[model samples]
Target: MAAIPTSNASLKDALLRPGFTPTSPAATRLSDPIADTPLVLTLDDVLPYDANPRTTQNPKYDEIKESIRQRGLDAPPPVTRRPGEEKYRIRNGGNTRLSILKELYQETGDDRYYRFHCLFRPWDAARGEIIVLTGHLAENDLKGDLKFIERAIAVEKARTLYEAEAGKAVSQRELASRLSADGYPVSQSHISKMLDTIQHLLPAIPGLLYSGLGVDRISKILALRKTASACWDKHYQGEGVEFEMLFQDVLSQFEGDAEEFFFDRFQDELVGQMKKPLALGYEDVLLEITQQQRELRRSMPIVDAPSLPAPPAAAPAPDTSLPDDTAPGDAPPQQPPELPEPPARLAQQTGSQVQLPVTPPAGDQMSDEERQARIDGHVVSPANISPRVVETKRKVAAALGETLPDFNSNALIAIPVQAGSLHPISDLWYIEHDIDTPEHLREHIAQLAFEITQSVNAPGEIIPVDGGIGFSYKQPADEVDITETAHHTLTLLQSLSGATAIALKMLGEQPAPAAMDALGEFQFAAGLGQILLGQPTARDQAPDDSGRLSDGALVKLFRIVRLARRLIDLEIQEYATNTSELNG
Candidate 1:
């Protein structure tokens, strides 16, 4: 190596010459010191570092600006002179303050706002990363404004720097300890979750970590990632729906409440939407039914076995002699014939009844299909009802007589039949209707009302349309008034559901009579007028000039009207019976 020329002009000429080269300096000058003490620099002189861990936009920006406006900058921002450049880059803090100052200067044109005080320090790039991170972490910890993503970034920077210096990977606990020493006192678990959020979530959904997501929410999201990943893997062979895809869906579903919506509810909604196939189905329905069964069994106590009729009064001693064939003191020559033992009465099992097929007539010939058809017919009739249901309906019909509506046309009849359970139609109704509480039935009625209104079709057929039906009309008419009447009836039906539910709940607290009275009151309120409307009445009552709805609308309307009327009639009958029984 040769020594370079010391003369300035000679050095400049040599540097400027295209082909001329000079020997490398023994040591590079680390920094240029602009100020020996705290100093003020114009906003133009300060620059942001390329890899500052803190984000440029601060969540506390408005507050910082307001504070600065009220009380002047309390602390100087930390900066370091570039190794050879005139501008100073922030080593750690002051990005927010710098932004606010620029904004204020732009708005107010104040020279004081344009200038900022910063502490300038010397930099050594070789060890500059750790030094910068320590300052950055301290500022963030002090302000408590760094998002999980920012913390993750700082940890990564520290880890990389430490690994480069040490020539190995750093354990999570060791990294956490180092971070704690730098003022970011994070636990290993928390840092692990933050790192997961950064690596797995941030890349897929950028800026989500800045969306007010805290450590707990981040942890839940990470858990969601694991669940979705496993579910997707198991159900779709790691294909089909992606974890990121479902996560984004969940984020969108609960856009405003994502941070508060935990994994359990999210998993429920997700499972409902996706319908992932699994070995077992949802257990809520089964659990509810089991609970209802227990309640029902509790309500109906087991009846004691009936006492056997006393045997015919014993005859006098002369007539009651044990045997006449033998003398006294000698054993009877022959024992009286033992009375024949009565056959054992069979006991009913808990679930399911298996019926044996009836024997065909003697010498009668029938094919297997014919016999099967006969068996099916024997079990269920042409109307698709079991003999048991027919018997139950028959018994109810005999008891209530004309009070009961035609079962074929009256949908309301199903409610009472399902409720009374004298001969239950089947176990299916309880599960099918989801009738654990009165609310379930009321919800069904609301759905039915919507369906019925949507099915209206005939002019002569009265439909429920006003009041609780909530339909809008251009102008009121006679038909509208009739519809309003129907609507009022439907509203009464809904009220009746709530009343019935209340009565059932009261049964657990009050006596049976009180509960029944409550139910009667609800029914009486529902039974205001003749619920069933005749077609002739519907036609004659309508004004000639009243707007006639389309036949399709009238059909839907008729269905609603018929069901509402039947429901009201049923309520009236039920109330009458209940009140009568209480009075008796």
Candidate 2:
């Protein structure tokens, strides 16, 4: 029941009057009048700040506690009491230290721990809680131990407090500006990334984020989620499945350790799950995801690189040439020619073949007898031959009237058939010549069509094409040229259809006249191409009563465009083959 001195002078005088010995060097340096005087307070007199950025115990908690127990608290933590609040709380940081003091008191029954010194700063109601929160943020940041998730949560809370005071929503730029002004300087871009992590990743992988996932990794995860979600939305048709739900399910498997989590593996699993729902091959999905990732990176704000100190001006090259010595013929002790630095190890060798070092397997470590015995245990039998191989051999024998002879066998007996020779001569010829089968040609055409649809832009826009050129539908400007553009467009369409017909002929499938005619139609070809590419044409965007293309017409047009593209590819391929043959 003693009155605590509020003034620095009175507090210092009180300390001296009690014959109090300064605990450490810190206590002796109290010459500054504005510096708050340390007060002797017990555990019951103060409270830990509830909104401290650090949610977990300090990593060096035991070491810190041992230090406090042996040498005593070197830095007295600053405490403050809000207006009308009797309990004093941590003003900035020192939650860990305070907790350690409490633990030490409980374990050792130490009065020294309980009656520790704390610097009390008067809290201002006008300055508000934002100041206090930002103070904790700055302190934790200086320590450089606050987890990314913890920082994100603290910043979000600070944003909430700012909004509450303003009575309106604050943009991320304004929030960043306010935070910097208060003391915690965070960039707007960083704030955006932090908010993204909190909104998208926190709910799914809280344990991972809290387990020290850093800002770079968190940004990557956000980027991946955005890319994968965009690809999913493009192809997903089912009613109930959500991209976020799939993302969470895939992410749960990787929540063990943030350090050990392989992001690429997670991406593979997420994309794999989407494969079925999106009706896309794994490679196709990955390609789309990669494109989306590139777009995201392009859209991200560029941060300026930190300025680096200029290299110390190279010491004037030691005048190494002869040093003005009088020995004329002594070729200035030629320094050994500096060896060129070796090239860095290549991540991947391209164009030229590389000789890779072949490592021996575990069997190489075994004794010769053990290795021989292991090899002898395994035997090849007829059951090992694939059914397709057997069937192929049967067909070959039927056509050849005898089994193919194995020239490698030197034994004087009737030659048996060779397993490798079972492949038909015509099949081998086609494969060796790099000729595509009908099935392969169809697959190639379909893939090309899909790629083109993805690449082309909506009609009337400048669509990028090969060689960095763009194509756009030309609109007639004057009365004289009204039909000129239309005539040229129709002529191009006719040429395309004719070329398709020629390719179909090469495939040994006579082109149906009706099908060719449909492909040549401008409305059918252009309109359906637009629809399939997810770009609505002027006709399709027309009013419902304005005679828009029907669903059936669109479907028919899609088929025509597909057929035309397939035939065109075949014709181009054939022409290339003939040209090469003539050159040979």
Candidate 3:
């Protein structure tokens, strides 16, 4: 057996390089002189690509090893050496195959496994490591083997290398373009999600991600974090708790195999924990998350499926009637028979009563166009219009806080002229205020407090309060006539604000509410004032044309409601304990 070359210098000087003058007939007949030349080398002479995108062992490791052990290496992996480097590493991929070769050689001491063929190619320093990294990524992508996290990490590394090459910060679009030019195509949106995963998720749940969590699940996790974080910030009162720390704590419990990691389970636990700091309920957190998901889906581009060709038309039915003027074998083409006109109407007969087609009522038979016309004309009375039209008109009226005249009567719809007993607002959402017992009242008050938070933070046009009253958060394009409901809603909100201020001052003399410090007490009062005053808007300033409270806004409102309920419960418990002590 021939001795193996030990050093880089010895290997380079002794090996028959591809660019060297060809002596064999096969080499001389080659069209390209610089084509890669296959060389037999010991396993130790070559190295696996250190920057391979695949981090885990091949799933088919045993099968591939058995195949190689029986038949030997059928294909030689292309290898290249960087400038000033002695060892040759994989040019594109085959790290797994290389590893299996090493294992086989060790297990059996087989010369065939130890000395295998490798195709050598010269590396170009001008193209740099970006080319090599992308090559591995492309190869792994073709095999469909790399995990989502592995691909994310590899892409991030590519971003760094590209930035270094460019000598400045590179945008995701530019990175995507550069990658596509280099034979590995990744979309800009995909790059953004990958970066988000690396920055936000990898630190918190590395096990879940590394164990094979897919892109779809990772996207969901990131969106949930964003929504939950926003809620935490809104309700948090500089209390020592941090959203990231809380997220990490919650995520740690669910860390394990990615397959076993239930996303819904994790989401529930994370939201449940967020309730305390965010002062929200599970439904509230879920609402925000659901809204985020909707926005994401809406933003994604729609790809239409390819159109299919229509089937051929069926042949017309054959005419069986024979022609009258020709020979038995010869017949003329048949023509379709025209229908005769209708007979005179019965009403046209002398002394007959004039009859007309029976039709349904105009309201019942109204078309969409006619309904829209009625809505445009401010005809929104339920008695005169279809239920759907009435609903549409009500939404518009509630959003604008405008009262319209009854379509048939031409008189304004009845509204409370004075703020007397609390009543339900027609065509708007209202909080129930009538309670027979203190326990029910407490629950009602707690619910009202929760809704107040939603009103302040939620996005849309209608802000419902007590006494058939509502307000619009958005400024109208033109001057809006404030109806009785709008006037009453604002008045009730203002009164509630003033009353809450007085209540907070009185509560300050007693012990702070449970889960609240001095700062929290102040924050709670301030939050209520903001809600009552209609100061807060949804995070996004964009108009909500839907005219209803957004899911996110509802979630935020519920969170405050939950916190308010907890505080109320705590205060009641303290009062009960004090009264019992006095009696004793």
lDDT of 2 by residue, 41-82 (tens): 789988999888998767777888888988999989888877
* Model 3 / residue 254 / CA error / Å: 1.6
lDDT of candidate 1 over 352-426, digit per residue (tens): 211111111211243232322222221211234576866775576456321222323121111111111111222
TM-score of 1: 0.40
The collision pairs in model 3 are 279-559, 280-559, 450-561, 454-557
Error of 3 at 13 (Å): 34
lDDT of 3 by residue, 483-559 (tens): 33233333334444354355457767877663255345454444444333434456775433222333333333333
> For residue 446, what is the lDDT in candidate 3?
38
TM-score of each: 0.40, 0.47, 0.48
Order of models, best TM-score first: 3, 2, 1
What candidate 2 gets wrong by more than 4 Å, as runs, is 1-37, 298-584
Error of 1 at 548 (Å): 59
User: Model 3 residue 55 lDDT?
Assistant: 87
The deviation in Å at residue 459 for candidate 2 is: 43
Name the regions of candidate 3 deviating beyond 4 angstroms. 1-35, 234-239, 303-584
Better of 1 and 3 by lDDT: 3
User: Global lDDT for candidate 1?
Assistant: 0.51
For model 2 the local lDDT of residue 575 reads: 79
lDDT of model 1, residue 494: 46
